[model samples]
Target: MAVLSEEQSMLRDAARSWVQEKSPVTAFRKMRDSGVDVGYDADAWNEMAEMGWAGVIIPEEYGGSNFGYLSMGLILEETGRTLTASPLLASGLAAASALVLGGSDEQKSEWLPKIADGSVVATLAIDEGPHHRPEKVEARFEGGKITGRKTFVLEGMAANLLVVSAKGPDGIGLYLVRADDGGVKRQRLQLADSRGAANIELNGAAAEPLSGGFELVEKVLDRARAGVAAEMLGAATQAFETTLDYLKTRVQFGQVIGSFQALQHRAAKMFTDLELSRSAVEAALTAIDNDAPDVAELASLAKAKMGDTFHLVSNEMVQMHGGIGMTDAHDAGFYLKRARAAEAAFGNQAYHRDRYARLQGY
Candidate 1:
């Protein structure tokens, strides 16, 4: 486990308090029922922005605190506990990291302040298919214009800017494409998670390329994968705790189910896996913050471990709860659905496990 500094602890506590008081699982249910196209509460996002949550990874000169990636992960972990749906991960961490790491001064000056202030939402427009495949991009950039389709863009419909990937003459490159361009069209995706995601069609839209080539995509994606692992850690922890509480109280055969040896063993395994997963997650985030050369390896480790742990815990959350877990009225279903969506987001267990092996020269 990574040791938290005084400020890091404070940030985690503040994030925890805010999520519990302002945005809980109930809030998520309400958002789903209300059919909000943005997939989050606008007022709540503004509140987070005012608290500087959106600017955690952005440099101070760019209107952010530049606290670092680990700090942002802490906030993400807290928010994940309640299953809060927001663009914080997409715009705040993923999109912001692209700018912080590779954005030209002109690009930084034009977009970073708006991102930090919550005035604009941005997200990556990569992956042309249903699965995560950055290296297989068929989109091409020529003559300062990009034409292609991007699917499953997180917070896509709400974004004002898209950090797009395409085949440049120099090789694969990142482009800053405006959503408001006439050539751009968006189709909101109604996912099982009910989050804000879209499929985009860019028809010869003007784009400004970022400095880094394919290498930069890999770097930006590492940050994204690590952040997702942090959020998964928070959700998995909560699921285990909630299930453990249910075990302690619910009676089966005239005794608390906690007395059952089989259930006790299952819970114990989950606790152990969660602890190990936390170590991997914190290590990955810390690696990014420290600019470690082995970041890709750690990222794969973190995401794969977190994916397996979350998949196990979420399945057990439903199985352990018995009947209530299967119903829409219970929050177990929410966790289960979220697990499926998040597991597939950046890379699933199979994907990351393969990546990890390849990185290790297997």
Candidate 2:
């Protein structure tokens, strides 16, 4: 198991408590009723920014905490538990990652400050089609102009900026494109999880090229996938815990169902699976943070294994809770929805499994 420093542990506890008190499951229920896609509670978002969560992996020079990836993982896990929908992951983790990994000094200096203060929301638009493969980026860049469409961009509709991937004469590249650019168009896509994302159409949108090329995009995508895996683990952990609580309190057949041998065995298996997923997620996070030689391979492994764990844990959680679990009024369904969405966010289990095998030189 990976250990956190005292301060990191304290920050994690604080984040957990803050989310529980300020943005509980009831809050999510309210957002669901309001027909909001992102479920971004402004007050809650402000509070998180105040606590420096928006800068979890940003540098100090950019008015950020410069905490590092582990701290970012901790915050993401807590957010996952609540099924909180916000631009935090899309902007804070994904966009910020692209900037740090590939942005020029001037770009970082200008953008990181706004991101740290929550004034700006950004997203990485990498998938040019339904297939979600970075290598399949068909967006074109020529003479400082970008032209193409990207789909399934998380927070794409709400983003102030977009880090878009494209194939240029120099090879594949990343470019920063302002959301309000003349030729850029965005249309929201309805996702099962109710998060805000968009299908973006860019017709010769102006762009500023990032410093690094294809390698930089690959690195940032790996980081984003690893982050999503951590978020999935967090969601699975909370789902298991919530289901356990329900089992303890809901009595059936003259006793708590949790006490029944069959359900007990199921819960035990869920726990084991959850722990295994946790270990994989933690390993990926650590490897990415340390720039370990095997980061790519480990990230793929974590995503593949944890994606399966998320599906199994969430499905069984709903099963254990019976009819109420399937109802929209219940919180268990929210967890299951988020699990499904996160599993497919960057890539699904099959996608990661193939990537992992390739990385292993198999």
Candidate 3:
């Protein structure tokens, strides 16, 4: 088990209480029904910035807390419990990770402060295909401009700055591109979880190169996978807890279903999976914080284990709840939808499983 310091515990507790009180699952329903252009609530995001969560992983020089990735993961876990949609993971962690690892001194000096203050929204646009493939980048950058289409960009529609990957003359390179520049187009995608995503087309859009290329991109992805795995851990655990409550109180054949041996066994399985996922996510977060040599493999392990567990727990959530679980009126279905979308983010269980094996030289 991972040990938490007093501050970390306090941070986790405060985030849990705030998310449950201010932005629960019902908040997501309201956002969806409102037909808003943005998928998340802006004021809620500002509240998070006030909490200093947006700068959790950044250095203090840039107005950040320099608390590290584990702290950020804890906050994300709390938000994920209630399915709170925000760019915390996309911009706060992922984009910031890329900039911290690859950005030049000037680059970091320019953008990190804005990211720390929640003044700018950013995203990493890497994959050009249906899935996560850092090495398969075909988008071209030449003459201080990028030209090509990037798909499945997280928070792409809302991000003002994009850390993009393309095949440069030297090799695959990372560049910062402005979304508002000429020849830039964004088409928002409607995802299962209703979290914002988009396909971005850059035609001669102005760009500035970041220091690291493919190597840094891969590292940034590992960090992203770990963060998402933490979120999945929280969501799966919440679903399991809610379902367990139902099983205890819900009656069948003139008795509480908790007394039935079959239902008991299913609940036991969910509990086991949820606990295992928690362990895996915790280990991954620690690995990142320590800059462990095997962080990449650990990240892949966390992503695969947590993603599969969430899928199982969510499916079982609906099955155990009966027909009402399938309806939009029930919150159980939303958990499943979020689980599917999260499982597909960064990489699915199958993709991460393969990556893990390769990392282990299997």
Model 1 misplaced stretches (Cα beyond 4 Å): none
Please give, for residues 67-125, the per-residue lDDT of candidate 2 as tens digits.
88778888888888887777888888889989998898999998999998988888999
lDDT of 3 at 349: 90
The best candidate in terms of TM-score: 1
Q: Against the unseen true structure, what C-alpha lDDT does each candidate score?
A: 0.94, 0.86, 0.90
Which candidate number would show the highest lDDT if scored against the true structure?
1
For model 1, the local distance difference test gives: 0.94
Q: Tell me the number of clashing residue pairs for each predicted model.
A: 0, 0, 0
Question: What residue pairs clash in candidate 3, if any at all?
Answer: none
Residues 1-362, model 3: lDDT tens digits:
57898889999999999999999999989987776665888888888888888899999988898888889899999999999998899889999999998888898999988988898988889888998877888789999999999998999988989999998878998899988998789998998898889999999999998877788888899999999998888898899999989988998899998889998898888888878888889888999999999998889999999988999999999999998898999999899999999999998999998988998889
Compared with the true structure, model 3 gives a TM-score of: 0.98
Residue range with the least summed lDDT across 10 consecutive positions in model 1: 36-45
What is candidate 3's CA lDDT for residue 144? 90
- Pairs clashing in candidate 1? none
